[model samples]
Target chain A: MVTINKPATKLNEPSKPQKSSSPSLTAFVKAFKNSIVLIVFILLWELAPQLGFVEKTFLPPFSEVVQAWWELLVTGELWRHFEASILRSLFGFLLALALAIPLGLIIGWYPLARDLLTPILELFRNTAALALLPVFILILGIGEVSKISIVLFACTWPVLLNTISAVKNVDPLLIKSARSMNISSFKLFYKVILPASVPTIFTGIRMAGTGAILVLIAAEMIGAKAGLGYFITYSQYNFLIPEMYAGIITISLLGLLINYGLSSAERYFSRWKQ
Target chain B: MDKIKFERVTKKFLVRDEYKKGAQREFTAIKDIEFSVKEGEFITLVGPSGCGKSTLLDLLTGLTQPTKGRILIDGREITGPGLDRGIVFQQYALFPWKTARGNIEFGLEAKGIPKSERKEKAEYYLDLVGLKNFADRYPHELSGGMKQRVAIARSLAFNPDVLLMDEPFAALDAQTRETLQTELLRIWKKTGKTIIFITHGIDEAVYLGERVVVLSANPGTVKKIVDIPLKDRLEDADIKSNPAFINARREVWNLLHEPEFQGAHI
Candidate 1:
């Protein structure tokens, strides 16, 4: 159990023996510290090349990577690559969400359905997501469908499993109270069960978003000509160190943006969690 | 017409656990109980835990089925829970997600009141409960006392003819419990709605009730019904100062200590 001290608001002393929790405000402090750490690492990386900590051919300075990024942006190459990667991840995420939630709700709501499906989902989920890339390429060709399908497969399990768990584990008291009020079962599912399961569902979505990004990038690296992954691989083979570093930076930025978008949404849906 | 009338009400609960030596244990919560409530009267049901005071309330609310009984209100059989019978649960069962106003609007919504009318009705109940300012706030934002008030507001929204409460204030601190009891009595007096309260606290039953109905433990049946005479139910005066209050509390407490009820608090 963890305890945290905070600015006191009430004069009353603790009446009950309970474990304390960290305050919400500390999250901002943690985030600020992380940014400082990242900046320090970047400053070190920039100076290492100049100090001959590594060969210049093998390593690029931070300024050179920024210059390559600027050139790519002007020529629309960076935008094309970034947009393709973003679109694939988004499309894959939406498809997985569409497939998972209702199926998860059914799987979660009924014991028989869950029993029939758990083994199949477990089997598929156990196989490494990347191993399916060749099979997908063989069936759909090395194109958008193949790359998006790979991402969709990777993202589906977490969303589906989380949704199932969320729906199954709603607070029993909420159900009892609603039933006592003569609330119809359908309305109970919509009003009480659905809303109660939201926090866990959001957790699944966050996982899916990150998983989709990782899978899409890996898939794109195989054959794609216009994506962040493709740019990184293409630049690496040609030994264009700065552009390769720029591609790595682009991937980092993409991940940061996606994490921010999903986390904020999680916050919005789980306002009552505290 | 009686606000509530239960005739030959016997409830049998099945203990379906296989480990029991027999097929199943038939534990009776309430047995051969019969009672009726007068219109607009406040009646309290006092008993040990699991003595069926709450089970009786649940039966009255149509939350559970009775094995053998007939429950009637105003002339019609109570087929299921309806707006006329509002129930306040022990745990402050206000929906966690909804604002105070949202909970109050629930019954009115079930009745299909117009949006504008429902809003007005919800605000009226909120004001009556002295929580008009907190209407927009969710249940999680409020303290335990505040949440119970919202639950009360929700129950009172439709001006239910018969309000059934199962130890609503028992979960609160002693101070909050006393304060809420006063507030509840004030609401009942102002609305003139019939109330059937269930509790184990003899003091609480005597403090808020117009009549305290005591029940014997397990296979529960009514033991006695003591009338409480308050000069002014609205005014917060010294109940202990009144000899009638003292006599009624002592009578009920003595009735609870009967020999048949020995070792019955299980």
Candidate 2:
């Protein structure tokens, strides 16, 4: 049967190959050229306030933010907040992965499950996870439970929807080919359907990873004593502009690290795609 | 007993009537399709588009049940797809995740063969298809011809007595197609499997088949079965251009077009 649904992302097509190889020096030069814009942007960020293009107190110089970041690291304050955020996001993400995948597979594969759950899923799918924050807070209280639950809620839909579509959209020809071998349904699911669904499922996983971080940060900002989000907002309230900038920078770096980790994992799983 | 049998089989699909609102109709794909194949014979089914050649194959593979009759293998009615028959599709449905050798091992694994023996068998068939060096390459890494070769090896690895090929070489370029055709004939001779090959091309049908079963389109049924008289056609390099090969090709082509011409007159 033909399944119609949008993919979470464009399938990860391999990038085109380089036309020719070059010396190590040339490769280093090319790498430098690629980073030119980023270097210029960083230079401008440092210069903008120093040259009075912006108010120094409101938007501190890049050097001051770096100094503040260094102090946070030295005092171990940043590590505490970082650890708390990481724990919440990781727990929520892992929890969502555990629940959503099997649920998605059932909904995708069996008509009974799909028919029963689809309407309720549609209602919840349309409702934003953040919008349910008050309900979560009201029910689970203003502790770790509410924050983690919100992150879990946010992460679940992307993983669930993408996985359902992934399993549904496996090439019918491959299924037919496997079926002709008189393979058991169990063998067919794992051998053909599961492997075929991996690339797309990983797409969902990566999206969930991003969502986990974003939601946990937001939840922390709304109410939390120790987290990057709390640290940033609290720093801003106390008129510690450089410390706030440091918190924001830390968050960006954390996002980058998370993205890099997930991308590497995706590449490892889909090595055969090359 | 015949190696495979199709006893007055018919298939119909329940389809939504596009021009009418909320209406359904039965679309008959093939009707009363009676045929039987002898052991160790290469039979090619040739037809125009919508001839239900594929439907016939689906029934034979037991992927779909016949709406009207029974299909049997070894004189026993087919319950469902089994290990006795293997199928190769034109699209080269090799799992992209599995390497060429892994794809071949899939069926053996389904048969619950031990890992070491499955690997040995996969390698043997990979060698048979002239893809020994490409055992570890995935389907996307291989060229079109190479992918099809791997698909053929995958189907053959399990050692099914009946091999059903649905235009397995149809997607290749002319040069590649002819090369694969020659290679297929060579493999058929080596394996001595009861082969049911399907194609829309007359030349392919005539070139490969010991006998060609021509099917007419629109409620497809067997129109005629023609035997090739050339004894050494497989060994003859110039057989396609040979007078006898041309005559047989012409005969199958005429059989395919006869219904169309009759419809035009009416």
Candidate 3:
């Protein structure tokens, strides 16, 4: 059966060709073009305080923030906090991935499992993860466990839902064609279903990666002592504005790094899709 | 002996009527389809849309069960899909994750063939389809016709006794379709495998088939089986202008244009 009745003309069109230039140089130019707005914003931030558009003590100059960031980096204080935050988010994200993917596969593959679990999933998905912070803290104690649990809770929904949808919606024709070859069920799942679902699953994974960091920061701000969130809060209370700015900058850079890494990994896995 | 047999096969689907409060109703997709395909014969199933041409192929592949009767391959009643029959879909269902060679190797992999042997076999089929140099290319990197060629190679690599195709060239442009049709005839002549090709194109059916099985719609059943007299003219450069080709095409076109089959045009 022709389940997807899209016109042949649409399918026949070739994907837009990539620029035929030296790869590294082309990538560098592309990156520079993409970051033009960010570069201008940074330049403006540096000039704003230098030109006395804002008080140095209140907002701090970009150079001062960088100096504070460098001092923290040299003393290994910033590294500790950065490392701590990374480890927690990574651990939580990994745990959620481990639990959700297989479970999503099961739910997607079997209609009964989907029916049994969908209501509970939908309920948890709609309820904000932060709103459950106090409950998590009370149940798991105000420690790394609660912070990690919060991150796990925040990341699980997107991964699970996206995986379910992806697995459920694998092109029926692909499966039909495979079945025509008498492929075993196990082989079909691995060879056909799993690869077909990877692109959508990666979308979920990227979202969960970002969500893990966002929720972890919020969780850290509540009770943690050595995370970027805690560091910024502590600096703000002590009127160390430059240190606060440094923490914010570190978070932004960390976010950018995580996103870049995930995208690269996504590209590697989905090279076939292109 | 017949290589494939459909023994009074019928398919019925219970489709829900949305306007009638979701009432379930029986839709007879095809009724009492009885035909036999001889070994090494190239047969074309020509009909309008909804005539169960695809459903017949599905039954032969054992992807869908015949609700009423049995389908047999080589005197054995087929229970489910086996390695004996390979199908090429119009959509060119090559695995997006696999290269041309890899897609061709898929059936071999399922049959538990050794990796090295699978590679050699894939290469052989790639060359047969004139895509030997494109074996390493992904499906997306190839043009529409090339992709379909890879799909044909993939089915052929398995070395099945029968090749079932469902409008395999309906998606291609006219030139590509004609080229593939000629290539298909070459492959059929070389391999001597039984081919049951389905198409809505009357001219294609007349050009490719020794016998064109014309199916009628609305509880689809055999309408007319037109035996083309111009089988030797398949390779003619001006075959479309040949009187015999024109006669066969007109004959099939008239059968399809019969009053009951009017609205069934694709």
Give per-model TM-scores.
Answer: 0.88, 0.94, 0.94
Selected candidate, larger lDDT, 1 vs 2: 2
RMSD after CA superposition, every candidate: 5.7, 6.2, 6.1
TM-scores for chain B, listed for all candidates: 0.95, 0.96, 0.97
Candidate 1 displacement at residue B191 in angstroms: 0.7
Q: What's candidate 3's DockQ score?
A: 0.58
* Superposed Cα deviation of residue A160, candidate 1 (Å): 2.2
Clashes of each: 0, 0, 0
Candidate 3: the clashing residue pairs are: none
Residue B82 lDDT (model 2): 90
Q: Which lDDT tens digits does candidate 2 get at residues B1-266?
A: 68888899889999899989899999999999888899999999988778888888888888888899998888899879998898999999999999999999888998889998998999899999999998888788899999999989888888899999999988999999998999998999999999999998888898889999988877888888999877787678788888889899889878866746366321
Best by lDDT: 3
Tens-place lDDT digits, model 1, residues B1-266: 78788888889898765786767877898987888899998999998766788779878888777889888899778778777888888888887777899888877776678888999999999999899888888787888999999989888887779999989998999999988998998888889999999998998898888888888867888777888886675564777667887888888888898787778872
Between which residue pairs do clashes occur in model 2? none
lDDT at residue A267 of model 2 (Cα atoms)? 93
* DockQ sort, best first: 3, 2, 1
Across all candidates, the chain A TM-score values are: 0.87, 0.90, 0.88
* Candidate 2 regions with alpha-carbon error over 4 angstroms: A1-22, B18-20, B259-266
- What tens-digit string does per-residue lDDT give for candidate 2 at A1-274? 3323423342225555545454455567777999999999888889999999999999988999999999999999999999999999889998999999988987889868777877887788678787888899899998999999998898888888878888889999999999999988998898888888889989989998888888888888888999999999999899999999999999998899989998999998898896
